[model samples]
Target: MENRTPIPDLIRLATTTADVDTLLQMMETFCHHFSYPFDRPLRQQLIRQMLENPSLGSLWLVVDENRPVGYVVLTYGFALEFGGKTALVDELFIEEGHRGGGKGRTVLQQIQQTADELGVSVILLQTEKYNPRAKRLYESIGFVDQERSTLMWKRPN
Candidate 1:
């Protein structure tokens, strides 16, 4: 079919506010279906804030077939253990149609490459155990669980 490609076509690039509205809608739908969170206003505001901050890291997006397939947003932070600014992959989501297609691994590898180029000491992320498929993907990419740190968040009031 015309829709099918002989080669896997995926691209990752920086994101801008022009992409926030659509990304928020996608994130909202993803959260709701997965019993996650869906607050469009907050997502919009978060994206805006990240866009305005140079230290907030970059949004390396995943696109396939000319449409956004997913995104990886990483922020940098100084870690005493690492002794430098490390990257934390705060968000990574693939569109429903692209799931199980093995594109996650490809995108993740791309990010790792970028991290190395940036001289990042670490790349970290969190995911639920219920998401075994995702867990496996991370494992294959050499991500081991950090036994020392536990993430806690206080969402804004």
Candidate 2:
């Protein structure tokens, strides 16, 4: 007998408005876990936008035996430095109970495959400095620190 980690069945691309509620709920949980502010209206709007225009990105739901266990948000971009198409792993959240069972790694592997198929020249992601576990997981799967600070600016509303 051999022991094997079960491969999670991730819903690769969320393509309908029907997934909004699940996405919002999971996103809220993710925000809380990371101590980030949860803005329902803004998040809802963004989810709707992504659903309406897949060119913007994709949302993947991690499922186990028909139950939703986690979700991932991947957004697209283009940069001359990256040779054109790029994908950002905007968010990846595995429910608390589902963590540490290889689900996250499996999902990331699938994401990489999808990106390759889409002609993405690069895949990028950021992890919170406070979450060493996540950083380790990412590094174990071939994501490396770019050795550059990531600065952001939000336009005034």
What CA RMSD would you report for each candidate?
A: 5.7, 3.5
Residue pairs whose backbone atoms clash in candidate 2: none
Evaluate residue 94 in candidate 2 and report its C-alpha lDDT on the 0 to 100 scale: 87
**Any runs in candidate 1 off by more than 4 Å, and if so which?**
1-9, 153-157
With a 3 Å backbone cut-off (N, CA, C), the pairs that clash in candidate 1 are none
Worst 10-residue lDDT window for candidate 1 reads 4-13
Q: Local distance difference test, per candidate?
A: 0.77, 0.86
* Candidate 2 residue lDDT tens string, 61-86: 88878678889998999999989999
* Per-residue C-alpha lDDT of model 1 across residues 1-157, encoded as one tens digit per residue: 3783443546555566656765776777678778987777887877777778857777666788677877777888888887687998887888888888778888777777677777788888888868887887898989998768788889899
Question: Best candidate per TM-score, number?
Answer: 2
Model 2's TM-score against the true structure: 0.88
lDDT of 1 at 8: 50
